[model samples]
Target: MNASLLLSITPYFPRPISSRRQCPLTVRRNARLQSPLCLASSSAPIATRETEIELENRKFELLRAVTDIQRGLTATPDQRSSIEESLVGVETFDAGKPIELDLLDGTWRLQYTSAPDVLILFQSAATLPFFEVDQIFQKFECRDQSGQGVVRNVVRWSIPRLLEEQEGATLIVSAKFSVVSVRNIYLEFEEIAIQNINISEELQALIAPALLPRSFFSLQILQFIRSFKAQLPVRSSQRQSVGGLYYLSYLDKNMLLGRAVGGGGVFVFTRAQPFI
Candidate 1:
């Protein structure tokens, strides 16, 4: 990410998560962890069969609302507020609960994000000479203490040189993250360092043109990926660090729904294969 991109990031996290380990929110699980480090417990009332059923139905409604919002490009202020309220009000998980390590760990691929930058990633798909398909995603691992861990956002791409008849190259732009706060329902990530990006021959070939006039993902713009990928060893001492407070509304073994604070947007995610 560059200065411009950093500037564009809205104040998505209204409150910075505590540096200290605090009581996390809540989670739902049918199983328990036998490890000394993990447990399925909560201060929230243990759901009875009826409660579980009701929770399931509410989740269904929220999911449906999420889908409807995603389909519409025009999201009213009320609609956005409703989305956030719905998410925060969701009882899919328990509150004032012990942090469940199992809930927090794993790779989470983005199903939806309200951020325009994310939308740009999708819109720019046509610029690559190779076919470009990717989803913005992140992964984290909670440590032994319920406190903190590392997080990585991977912009994985399946870029194929279809015109050249060569195999599509797998391109990845990874951003390193530090967990600032680890609330059960929320997370704060600050980019620490960006690995050097060695532009591949295939990628170079794809974007060798002088430029595409007035385009979002022209060869010139795509080079941001290179700068961000370069100089991995140096950590960013940001005048402003890019990060967000994610408000998790729903979570289960297979799915997650979260909305960034400040009405930035809602997101849907599923467990990715090849979990980190």
Candidate 2:
């Protein structure tokens, strides 16, 4: 996030070629004059090919540099603050409201509902964080009032966070959609239900080691459990209606707490003075 790091990494992007062109024939003639004719002819083609390859490589390098810069900006607090300030004049929508979209089968669409100024700021803020936009699809069948089933509709929309390195070394984020049906809706909802999927071994290897330390992992699990507990609302109906009872039962069955409880025995009753 430091400015120095940005500057140090900037060289990875290749600079544009100067507009001034070199005369190939003249260079060939000059080479022939200094070297044997046969040698010059053989080296000329090789030199041209090498130059072409170098240029192509430089272009790719430039693209990667640009992408890195944008990605870095996404994680920077200053950039986020700037974007929020820019959007101050624009109307903001509730974060929880579902954004409406329309789609066609086998196609993706990107739409923006925010004001132009707000959009500009949003894009500026997100420019570095995303890589590409794509469309995902599914099929569904529905029945009309007549109770006859029909292959009803197709959906389309853009997917944010899809990265593309080949095209201009840039990242993009966009919204996407698909068909409307019970199955499709269920699948989409299922995705939302289990959005916190754990990283696979292969993916973990790609992540920075610092980000996945043992302490961090432990803290994450603790935080998850704490949030889960906090979300269990208290019901006034009955003790059985509260999720905490079930949670306590589960803890006392399979966990260390359960073992401790098992080690404790019930108290003995004394009846010596009961008659008096």
Candidate 3:
């Protein structure tokens, strides 16, 4: 199972261990298990088992779908487009359960996406993100708003900084973004902006070139929004968003699969515990 955790395109996905166990047979046979006076309906156990089986089956199917795309990551554009379409079509993973907004808080690393074009100029690499990505991630925090409100951001990851000699080096370009958004099928937000950016010697060295340019990496990447280039903002004098919507199709404790509304992109992400 640990090995399967690396099933996504980034070559590393974190999967949860199966801790879902059914009640003991004897306990199920008893009319009351947890409460003396409260009795479980006869069909409860069977329904639960069926639900478990359905979830397990869906998990396996998603794993296979992810693997298929990851394998085709390096294929031709037409082929990759086909694969991406198929990947989006396999969005049966989410059980339509309510998302625990609290659990959504944390750092998440991008692994795969079906909708790359909506937010970028060039196509992403089939194997890796089309950039010298030291690391790409987004962080979410609960906004002091009502339920399902969050402040989402995409922050770190630098440009090419002479890899070999740099020992415990600093980040060059960090896109610090913070935007209030609603947490639902699509992390919908209207006003999107860079918020702020911290530059370093690497970007300084390339002072002649465009700093924090869209084409440099991916346009969608800069917004640091949740999921794909979700809710593509219309010619943003404000900032880049998305043409379609972003759907967090699948999410476990460790793995996340984000898809674009309509038929476009799906991004895979793995949960990363923030450094202490």
User: What's every prediction's RMSD, in angstroms?
Assistant: 19.7, 28.0, 14.6
Ten contiguous residues minimizing lDDT sum, candidate 1: 162-171
Cα lDDT tens digits for candidate 2, 75-167: 255543433332221212112232122111122111111124223434544564543322211222221222112111111112232212222
TM-score of predicted structure 3: 0.46
- With candidate 3 superimposed using the best TM-score fit, by how many Å does residue 158's alpha carbon deviate from the native? 5.2
> Residue 66 in model 1: shift from native, Å?
3.8
Each candidate's clash count: 3, 14, 11
Clash pairs detected, candidate 1:
26-94, 196-229, 197-229
For model 3, state the Cα shift of residue 74 in Å. 2.5
Model 3 residue 152 distance off true place after TM-score fit, in angstroms:
4.4
Per-candidate local distance difference test: 0.53, 0.28, 0.47
lDDT accuracy of residue 81 in candidate 2: 44
What are the runs in model 2 whose C-alpha is more than 4 Å off?
A: 1-35, 69-276
Which of candidates 1 and 2 is the stronger one according to lDDT?
1
